[model samples]
Target: MTSFGIATAPQQVEYADVLRVWREADEVPEIEHAWLFDHLLPIAGDPDGPIFEGWTLLSALAARTRRLRLGLLVTSNRFRPPAMLAKIATTVDAVSGGRLDFGIGVGSRPSHPLARREYAAHGLPFHDTGRATDSLDEALTVIERLWTEDAPFDFHGEYVHLDGAYGNPKPARRPPIMIGGRARATLRVVAKHADLWNIPGGDLADCVARSRMLDDYCAEIGRDPAAITRSLHLGVSYDAPEATREAIDAAVAAGFSHIVLGLPAPWPGGVARWVADELVNRSPAHRGT
Candidate 1:
């Protein structure tokens, strides 16, 4: 049997109100995990537009919900230092009673002046794929060591170094590490280290092909393909007046353990409710298998 889950863009609505409603909604027995998106600025539209910090909001959600596991669909490595990110994740996992998974990626924000400005502020050199991926790999190594090692661990990487450093009060459970991206390098990293892989926007056949590719990579690396969980991000529009159950079923047939649907827009009334009902509730047994 499989399970079903939902991932949403961060609450752009009034923070307090959205938190209240999300806390309640997450209590529903059918919802397995409540996911948030990681973006320093809006991926679309104006950069000045309202956008909540993903990790901060997830930390708050950890306190507000009891059962729902919290995580980012994919966090970028360019945003913060690996040690700091590891600390934040550890804190959230402890706060959530060991129910946090750290999903990260090497992707950047969509093209926009404001987005570029924000990236510059973070000292990130956007459009440099090598730099971005190198940073991501180093960050992953640091965070994983922080989560698993008890004694002071020393890391000497090109981008990061630690000299007998220790993370106090480690996460109650070592949060699972998830890496996402369709690039060949990304897939190789997934085969080497990821607990889960999030593949974005593809048809069923595409998904199966990607899954097989990942399996082949894993086998070549002497890793078990079954050890990694596979997930998909499905963009859904509730206003379409028709559910995309066929696509969802196709994803399942391709061995996706989780399908994350993106809501068209955040409206506090019937539209949001309709999306929750028609999309997330379409299948309850296809997640976390």
Candidate 2:
């Protein structure tokens, strides 16, 4: 069955509005999970628009909601050291009673000028995709060890180095890892580490091709391709429900089972239930309901 989720990017949106939508979604069985993005600056709207920090906002949302599993859509490995991120994720997992899906990836690429500016604004070094992917590979290794290892350990990687690293109170349960990206290098990492792999929806053929590459990578590693859930992030259309439903149908038909509807900001009242009825229920996957 296809599981549905909602992603509310914090850019140009009010905290109360996001909270309200999440609270409503918590009561709706159709929406099983929720997500926030990790950009420090507004990628959309005015340059000076207010944008909340993703992990901090996620922690607050975790405390306020009961049923929804939540996490950032994809945390930037460049933003924080892996050890610190692991600790932060552990706290959120404990707060949400072990309902975190740890989504992470290489930070925004240099190709996106808007996204690129934020790194300079925040005094973060924006490395090339090669270096970024290398860092992400190391970050995942360090994060996993921190989450599951019994004793404090040291890691000395090219990008991340840890000395006597340990998580005192681990997550209520270790959260599943969700890695988002469509690049081949990222897919290699996804095949080895991720419990779920996510890519933005638009080019169905491109996404299927990427999935196939991931399958080949998995096979090379002697791991089952089915081990990772294929996830898609399709933008929700407030005015065109049929378009969103068509995208959902196409994604599920291509073997993508985990769907995340990206809701636009300044969310309308009762938007979660609206999404459930207008998009999810109307999709071919939910026909005969």
Candidate 3:
């Protein structure tokens, strides 16, 4: 059975409002996961717009919701050091009773001023895509080792390094590590390290093709393709004439185990209600009464 999830643009709404909406959604049986977008600055044209820190908000969400799994839709590798990021994730997992999923990708919001500043601050080779991919590979290794190993795992890579560093109180559950991106280098990283794959900016056929590639890579590496969960990040607009119910049905049929509905800009109150009614209420699997 397909699991339906929600991905909200928290920066567009107040933190209190987001917490309320998430709590309500958690009570709704249809919703399985609640995702938040991560960006150093607003992705839209507003440089002075309000933006909440992704990790901090997620840590709060972990405490507020009971049944819903929480995570960033995708975190930028440029935002924090890999070891620190892993530690933060572990703490969030412990607080949430092991309901966290770590979704990560190479930087995407370079157009934002703060994001550009972050790139500069880190001295990240943003101009060189190859260098960025290499950095991501190193970061992924550090994150995974931190979560799994009790003894300090020494990692000496081109971009990241660790020497007899210890990570304690591992997560109650080994929260799934999801890698996002459709590019070849990104997919290779997913094949090598990710327990889940989140595909964005693609149609069903494109997603299917990418899924096949992931499976092929898994086979090449002697890993089981079925072990990796496949998901899609959908840009959903309630105003569209297309029925939301049909859209969800199509998504499930297309093999998306998780559907992360992208909130429209300017978080309209009715959008959440509409999703609860038209999508969650109408679904036979989640109708409360």
Candidate 4:
């Protein structure tokens, strides 16, 4: 059965909104998880907006929530070094008692000058698709090494090189790696790395076509397509329970097993209750992890 999670926008300044959603997730039996956008600023280009940094929020959430799994919908590979990020993920996994779903990806806003400016300020490389994918490939390798390797080793790669690479604590368990994107290179990375593939462009026919394409990529790499869970990230209204259920049903029909909804802001408590009470249980989709 299709699972449901809420992906809250960070651009909005409501600290209450983030807490509210987690609170609802705690109260609702159907919400499998909750996510945050990993952006530094509002995508709407508002510089003054209060975009709570995702990792910090995630850390606090790890300490706060008991049942809801937490993570970024797709954190950019450009922001932090993968080795450092691995430590962060491991720490969160421990704090959350092994409920972290590590979702990551290439950048989302390629043309935003503000983002580019920030990248430059941080000394992070903002390369073209090929270079970025190369870096991500290397980053995933490093991240996995840090999580899995007990002995110190050397990580020599095209983008990042480290001597005596080691990561401790190893996450209560290695969290599931979720990679999101639809680019040819991105899909290749997803096929090679992701435990859950969050497909972009969430139309039914488009999702079906893309899933088939992803299956081909998996086969090319000698992987079982079913080994990776299929997820669709979308902006579906929870303002009405019936409408939301309709959207979820459609996604499931298109072969998406996990559904992450980006709810509209101005948090509606009543709508949330509707989902908790009326919709999620009514759906035949399997209860998600």
Highest TM-score: give the candidate number. Answer: 2
Write candidate 1's Cα lDDT for 1-289 as tens digits.
Answer: 4445566665345576547545755656555666777777676655567778889988898888888777998888878788999999999998898999889998664544655676776666675767677778788888888887879988898888889877887888778888888777778888887998888766667777888899999999899999999988877755553446666766777788766665544534543345456754564443333
- Structural similarity to truth (TM-score) of each candidate: 0.89, 0.98, 0.88, 0.91
Error of 1 at 72 (Å): 0.7
lDDT of each: 0.74, 0.92, 0.77, 0.79
What's the ranking of the predictions by lDDT, best on top?
A: 2, 4, 3, 1
Candidate achieving the largest lDDT: 2
- Please, what are the lDDT tens digits per residue for candidate 2 over residues 164-217? 999878877768999999999999999999999999776999999999999999
The runs of at least 3 residues in candidate 2 whose Cα sits more than 4 Å from the true structure, single-residue gaps closed, are none
**Candidate 4 backbone collisions, by pair:** 1-285, 1-286
Between prediction 2 and prediction 4, the one with superior TM-score is: 2
Q: Which ten residues in a row have the lowest lDDT in candidate 2?
A: 280-289
* Model 3: lDDT to the true structure: 0.77
Q: How do the residues 40-106 of candidate 4 rate in per-residue lDDT, one tens digit apiece?
A: 7666546656778888888887687899888888888888888999998888899899999999998
Shift in Å, residue 259, candidate 3: 0.9
**Prediction RMSDs, each to the true structure:** 2.8, 1.1, 3.0, 2.4
TM-score of 1: 0.89
